[model samples]
Target: MATLAPQAPWAMRLVTDRRPIGPPSYAAVTLDASTQRARYTDTAGQVVKMGEHGTNQTNPTTSMSGGGDGAEPQPQTADDSTPDYSSD
Candidate 1:
């Protein structure tokens, strides 16, 4: 008489569909530098505009200090600089 063997593990398979959904739609926006404003447009060429720099027009300057350690010294001679050589 023959003996029965153990069954192998089962695995799931993926399914795919191929079809065209509908007409393609496009969305875009434009930035106007003359007025410093932004304009948005939809697929049908309808534009929605917005303005910027309402109150805070100028950018603030930020100061960054050196590390607590003292500044490094500058070299004087060409020998102190990096050595350069021609490679043929």
Candidate 2:
């Protein structure tokens, strides 16, 4: 998912087609500076034409503050060979 701009008349966010079917039709895409990854969208009104694209856009400061990716964090593993001295 991507946001049009951090702040602007259209600060709308969008979910991109990660796996586009055929050749890309020059769908307006933007690169999120914070993530260093490009964000796109197949939904209309979200994407724009070339040259009409915006720049210097970034993710909202609180984009992920509400909650993480919604995935639980993985637990750290212990050294199988090491004994549990703490129990003693």
Candidate 3:
């Protein structure tokens, strides 16, 4: 149940050569367990699917709630520091 995020602007993608390469990447890309899918989109709008979120006893879920890890998502608020462009 580890979430990997880009501290700088880089994301490593293992290419055919089996080497990790990335720079000037994303701010954050979370590997969510809700849908049991691992996917991420970078600053260049490239969607990458690594793998699926496997099942584990540490993160049990009810059948009714789907395959979520039973952890509630934290609420996120809009960044008021940024300027609004509704007029535009």
Q: In order, what lDDT does every prediction score?
A: 0.53, 0.50, 0.51
Q: Identify the candidate with maximal lDDT.
A: 1
Candidate 2, residue 40: the lDDT equals 69
- Name the candidate that leads on TM-score: 1
Q: Order the candidates by lDDT, highest first — what do you get?
A: 1, 3, 2
Superposed Cα deviation of residue 56, candidate 2 (Å): 32
lDDT (tens digit, per residue) of candidate 1 on 4-65: 78655444234345786884343777777898766577777777554443543343344433
Task: State how far residue 21 of model 1 sits from its true place (Å).
Answer: 21
C-alpha TM-scores of all predictions:
0.24, 0.21, 0.20
TM-score of 2: 0.21
Clashes of each: 0, 0, 1
Clashes of 1: 0
The digit string of per-residue lDDT tens for model 2 on 23-62 reads: 6655557787999966664547364444443344433222
- Cα RMSD of predicted structure 3: 23.5
Identify the runs in model 3 with alpha carbons over 4 angstroms from their true place. Answer: 1-27, 44-46, 51-88
Q: Which stretches of candidate 1 lie over 4 Å from their true place?
A: 1-26, 49-88
